[model samples]
Target: MNVVSKIEAAAPAAAVEAPAERMRRVVAVAVEHGDAVDREGRFPAETVEALKRERLLSVAIPAEYGGEGLGTAAVADLIAQLAQACGSSAMIYAMHQIKTSSFVMHGTGSEWHRAYMRRIAAEQLLMASATTEAGIGGNLRNSICAIEVEDGRFRLTKEAIVISYGNYADAILATARRAPDAASSDQIMVVIPNDANRTIDRTVVWDTLGMRGTCSDGFHLEAVGNAAQIFPKPFSEIAAQSMLASSHIYWAATWFGIAADAFNRAQAFVKAAARKQTDGTLPPGALRLAEAAAKLQEMKGHLMAAIHRFDAAQVDAARGDDAALSSIGFAAEINALKVAASEKAGEVVRIALLVNGILGYKNGTPFSVGRHLRDTASAPVMISNDRILSNTATLLLMSRFDTSLGG
Candidate 1:
């Protein structure tokens, strides 16, 4: 069965159609434009439009806000399916969901944020994030910009080094120091609606080796909004409780999708080679195909395990056990998932290319894995696997590893 079919079979019936069914058209649109989007380093406008038309963008929002109220696993699956068709579109969607998760999990307390959630659902708005700054050097936990508040309104000016698809976002979630005198680590997350009060000045072009359609250019961002637009919780708490887990899980799913597609192409090439033989002998690449398939399975198992752990943690967190979400073990495991998935994705793609040999090296053939390789190549550096490992190593120093399977 196909990915959509699996989603349909596993999902319980609801009043609205399953998100998987809706994603079918989106995947088709993405596949149609994936090559051009990559070639021109442009946005996947058609694919995003299909998502809006199907109202899939609001799948992560709560039901109270005119959304479907789907859980994390469901959204991750959809992201993986989209990634198989177009990596850039899938990353764009994944990043949007990460930003949406912050609002769904933390923004409902304030009336202003609640209303914004409603708007996000009702209008199918897309969200971008501005956490990486010029001075911080990819450290989201620290910020040089500060939000200036006066007379119940606030203003912020940030030199963001990378805001993925910022020009096309309807709103942006930005991080900044809580006050002018606050420590760089003391931060807040504010919602900046793309209105007349907001301006994005392009500062750097996004010409990269892979995942070209993301348009992750640098910008000078200035925005004004009511103080109420900010979340009640600190950015640190928000990152621990929602953003961190969601980003890693969903991103791993995207990489998995890219790897899965590459494997599929490799399998096709192997099968074709086998068919050409009259003695019923397997192709020389068959053993390599088997090895790649095993690695792919390992990657999927790791992602699914992380998803279940995250869901269980969310349940505990909802029951007032904040420690469940804040535990060092959980954080370390999620970080490991990102590192493993990123590395394994590149490995699987490389194996697939080896299986297909010269054909996989080409760009326009049915067995081509060139785009898949390019796209997966960006996985490790997205958050920098080295940085994640460094953080995980620090976490491990404070906690003991659990050896039991049940644990």
Candidate 2:
């Protein structure tokens, strides 16, 4: 059988049991179909459709919402594995998870909450995140979108860009400036149906060195007014809710998976070539490549340990105290992992390129590592290394003091 066919065949087997396993299966199918979809610039319709049928896309909903209800660790693992195979698919999945977090934070008490979750569970109601904006970026403090309350109703309008699935999502979770007088960062989130009269300008095209399949095209919203199922709470509450229970962990997993993929591909190539070049001579290049693999493995271990700590801290928070420690710790570890993973992936790609030489550049060769290298390169930029380290240091410094923020 061909490589794609082999990947397709492995999916169902992987998904036979748990929700996470099912997500893994979904990812396998996405990867199997990735090359063709990317070639045509088409969405992974078949893979996404399969996820709907298998209930993989709805796995994050609360159990009461007719879903499997997986947690952060499981979610992260699934995204990472999918990303390792198809970064575009993984990005799409990450958008969905982010939307789900927003829903839980803001839509839980709305009249449409249960119905929306039910529909998501039963149908291929694709989800996307309309977070990033034009010049202002995704900063909550300076959002350009606004909600004007009028006679017991809310009118929402936004001008956003680069929505992960903006081209074709059944629903979009959008952030807008809340009505003035609402508390800090008071950004409001709403679920807008794709058909809601929103104008998509297809503004800035997604032309990147990696994640080419994400199709993160630009779009604009021109006074698309829905009865704004007002999230039934203050905007500050929603902001805190999202920050407390976010899907940041899952994206971290994707980065780790990309790193792992690079390491695995390079290792396989090196081992095979080593056997072929056994003219009783061990070259320094081969030795250095082996050392890099070892370092990559260490990074993998650190990532896994971080996942464990994050999960445990989440459990602890659910039982009693808040997950402030876990959140800060995970952020710190993720920063370290981002650097380690990105650097190692690049190193592995370089090694593979050097070791495979002409064969590495060949289209159909197993040693082709260019795409993986590019994909891994995005990790560092995704979550700024300086920002995370600074946050961690600030948190640690504050912990040592007994003083309050305000007198």
The per-model lDDT (C-alpha) reads 0.92, 0.64
Query: By lDDT, who's the top model here?
Result: 1
lDDT of 1 by residue, 1-407 (tens): 85344433533442258789889879999999998999999999999988877888889898888788999889999999999999999999999999999988898788998898888876778999999999787899999999999999999999999999999999999999999999999999999989999999999999988899999999999999899998999999999999999999999999999999999999999999998999888878999999999999999999999999999999988888989788999999999999999999999999999999999999889888888999999999998999999999999899999888994
| lDDT, residue 402, model 2 | 28
Clashes of each: 0, 0
List the candidates' TM-scores in order.
0.96, 0.80
RMSD of each: 4.9, 6.3
lDDT of 2 by residue, 315-374 (tens): 665576545433544455554555665566566556666765666666556766666667
